[model samples]
Target chain A: MNDRNRIPIIITIMVILLIMVIGFTSQQRERLTPVEKWIGDFFMPFQRIVSQGYYGVEDQIRTLIRSSEIKQENEMLKEELHHYQSELIEAKLNREELMELKNLQQTLNSIDRSGFSEPITANVIANNSGNWFQMFTVDAGERKGVGVNSVVIGSGGLIGRVYETGNTWAKVISIIDNSSSVSFRVLRDGDLQGIVSGSVDNELSGYLFDPDAEIIVGDQLITSGIGLYPRGILIGGITDISTSADQLLQNIEVEPAVNFNRMNKVMIINPKIYEE
Target chain B: MRRLFLGSLFFFSMIIESTFLSYLPFPSLVPNTTMILVICFALYYEEKNGAIIGFTAGLIKDMIVGRVVGISALTFMLIGFLVGYYNRKVFVENATTPFVLTAASTILHESIAFVAVFLMGYPIHVTMALNRIYLYQTIYNALVAVPIYFIMNQILHSHFLKKSY
Candidate 1:
């Protein structure tokens, strides 16, 4: 084959491959086959090694750039911490009294115990590189008992859920992705439930189950334990509230508790599997 | 043999983009290394080799980070092939070819990806993607192209590329 004639042949091959790939991918969105899982597992170690080196250098650079701001922030945070510590001591005493009352009430009425389990810690290996969508890879999978739909929590609160997994690695879809939706209730008003879903922007949105439900700014939102997530995990705080012109539903915005920018590690909740 | 080397390079580039680049200051503004590599190869290497490299690179990318596979594969492969076709007309040896090509091809790649994702039922915010991703990536890629091109040029001239034509 002459050099001049090679371009057309290559283009033909590429077109065929493109069509085949697109067709194959469109059908396999949710999970990967065993072979695909094996491939991902094989490459996970290299990704981990690279991530460690990358993060080490990254932290150094960031520290140098933000030293002055950090100093000021450190002092402010110290004062805040002292104030919060005093409040926490008081809250602990109230919590103890509440637990005693709850135990007495439980003795009077038979209630099933909440089945929340311990979490498996995992190191994040990779984050979203191409699109505006929020997704990440964590270095835990079937080996560590991380499975599909496992809820992941970061420093402050809920981060996301494990979307797909191999033998040694898992992919997490952040709560901010357009497709992810979490059933939540206003922590202040336990009766009010809604579905918090991701949108095009950074913030998340949910509609009040009752259009008349009063949603105030700064209200805390927590998982309602209806579907995927366990009940009572802090999801975010309400940042905005509004009603459409027709007033069919009240639209609310939530700011997630986890700061994705600083998240390096997460915990995957492993629900106990009851044997059939 | 050369294809294997390029394939691994592409894979390594993927790892870097996902991990290293994400930590950079203003990480969102980091250049698209995969696009840069593809365009550089398309501009400098033979048309056929460029397309094959681009296809393999995109597939590796899709396997790792993509929510829906093959969207990036189609986008990058097409960009590689189109840029390669114009290689004959463009002066590959010119100092500024890579910078110019990188700038043009970034827009082309992002636009194609946007269209493909849109077709796949993704509700993309066109203006936001255009401003945040496409525009910033183009400028960043253009800036990074100078160093990447020179390094790649050196590597090619050292042994991998022989002046057979």
Candidate 2:
């Protein structure tokens, strides 16, 4: 290309870049536009194929890593199995009795039952190519009854909440993001309530309602049914606790139960009208 | 017709980057394929075409990512233009140009993205972005450019191969 042609091209490229920058900057950052949604829906099939491919590769890697450990675990499990065989009958009878007692308790505190409902399983399709485990896309969307604000959980516990929905896909904001906060309470002491918030380092820290609350290390935390997340979902275990002399709240730190690095499949809670 | 093919290639690369790339053990280690392609095309073709391809690819990426729409587009266009323009000045048909150009473009592209993302009101850690995105991706993308350059060169030169008489 000659100088004359090059000049025009450079000018055109700069003009387009400027326009796009201005246009995009002015748009809302929180919501996807119609065109963006259509583009995402268009790529849904490709997303599924890639998602499967990703999981297949991850499974192979996990298998390779666990190959040696599996042998030891197998030996351990077999020994434990023989021991449990003798106790299985007694445990079954105890479970039956416990079930009867639980039924009586449920009848009494039926209204205060933990806020948990069945979930809709979804495949994790894609993630933002960044070190921060903040955002990811799931294969279920409005078409499959997935809506924004639906709680998402993996095998371990609370992962995040669905923040954006397209026709065939929904974007999940993981609990590890800087913008995420969840209302939680101590599993051992239900009255000890607090709000756990995510930081840039993918750790959770928060403050308890009472500065005088005696929080101990290893205290398991669960959702308090205060926000979009349902009640009784395991958030994590408290790792550290501290309190300043003049502060009104105790500083608490929690290590999340779900490992964001290994997350592949998640279950999204469908819209259910819980009795308030 | 060739431009159309190149456009399709960029589009497919974006799809793979967004979907398949996420599954890699450390996804941040995966080279930015589209950015490498942009640099390769700019060096092989001309700066003008490179800028256009980069812009289109960036637009598609932004749309699929559902983030700020212009950040990638602007970053890609500028990187494409600078790489292409300097590629013409250097006019070196040697083996080192693609690697060097790819590295420079990757750093430029990622820096532009970091600035644009920050401007869009998203909190960014400067040192982390520089190390993870700029440095890591530049090295990875430069390495990726080697094979991609050879493959694209072969495809572009296929018509030039005469019959074995």
Candidate 3:
């Protein structure tokens, strides 16, 4: 073909390509299949290498600047460490009491523990940087019994759920992701169900459908013993609420107790497999 | 070949921006670097190539971040096409011009994104969105513009620009 004719043809091809991209992405949103999982896994090593390199440099610079300060702080921390040790014991006691209370509630409610499986621990290897959502890739994969729909929990509470899982790695769709949803209940109240959705601003907030539901600002939100997550695990606390004029339901905002920004380790809870 | 290279570069930049850059404690409410570099490339390259690269980069972003499809693609394509057309008309071959072009393009790109989100039936606070656009992110992108453009330009020149049309 002549050069002038070729230009128009190229433009046509580009337009066609653009349409194809839009169509493909729409399908991707609905289902991320095995192929997509493979691609994500294929790219995992590269992502890890780049993140490690960047983090190594940053850590080096930080260590250099903070070495002296760290030493002085260490002595002061040692003094405070004694008090912290005592507080740790009290905290452990409180935690145990909370767990016992949770167990009692489970027994009262006749909650099924058969589906609860041992959790797999994984290290966060990378994080999403530019996007408003908070996401991380973990080292555990299919080999380690990590699969899609697995629940990830950090120190404070639920962090996210696994969206994609591969043979050697998995990508977590954080609770901070706009598409993520968690079924939760008010721990202080009995049998109130609500859905916790993520915002574009990387904040975990949700709406309570029941206007009469007894929910307060500091009330703890826990998984509702339904859907992909297990019951009795802490999610976060209700921070703000706005009641509509009609007052059918309240617009509730939750502040996730989990410090996702500083999260390094996570426990991936796999659903139990039963044999007939 | 040029298109492929530019597309890959933009993809890589987006990956780097989302993974590594997000962690740094910058003096801004929201820090972003991928769109800025994509805008710079769009300003320098041909219009069609610019749009293609922008679209690809935006697709990768949506895939990773889980936004409704076509939002970033639509926004970046518009930014790239306009910037490319502007570069064709006005000869911007200096250091300062690229920086200025990036700042202007970043603002336009971000506004388009804001509008796109708003139009998608999502609840958006105009004041909060405006604050993010004008003060925090705009300044952050402007400050990072020079260095990012410098690196991107070097890579483009070496890998793709050398093969002249």
Q: How does each model score on TM-score?
A: 0.83, 0.78, 0.71
Clashing pairs in 1: none
* Candidate 3: regions farther than 4 A off: A1-20, A27-39, A52-113, A129-134, A141-143, A207-216, A241-243, A271-276, B1-12, B26-34, B39-45, B51-82, B107-123, B133-135, B151-165
- TM-score (chain A) of candidate 1? 0.78
Each candidate's number of clashing pairs is 0, 0, 2
TM-score of 3: 0.71
Q: Model 3, range A1-276, lDDT digits (tens) per residue?
A: 764346446545654665555455532142465654665565667666776677678778988999999899999999999999999999999989988887897889876444556779987766752333346777788889876778899888898887766677777877876667899988987478788887666678788868788777898989887777777789898899888788887878889978777656789987544100
Comparing 2 and 3 on lDDT, the stronger one: 2
Say which docking band candidate 1 falls in: medium
Model 2, A1-276: lDDT tens digits are 777476656657676766666565443344567877898898877877877887898789878999989899999999999999879988999989977887888898885443445578998887764433367888898888877778899999999988778888988888877668999999999999999988545678888998888789999999998877878999999999988678777998899999876677899985454434
Candidate 3 residue A271 C-alpha distance from true site, Å: 4.2
lDDT per residue (tens digit) for residues B1-165 in model 2: 665676778767877776777556674355678877787777766777777777777777766664456666777777777778887787777678788878877777666655655555555567776676777767777888888888877866666432221
Interface RMSD of 3: 4.4
Cα misplacement distance, residue A163 of candidate 2 (Å)? 2.9
Q: Which candidate is the best by lDDT?
A: 1
- Superposed model 2: Cα runs more than 4 Å off: A1-31, A57-68, A71-118, A131-133, A205-212, A240-253, A270-276, B1-4, B27-29, B160-165
lDDT of 3 at A233: 85
Candidate 1 vs candidate 3, lDDT winner: 1
lDDT of 1 at A21: 70
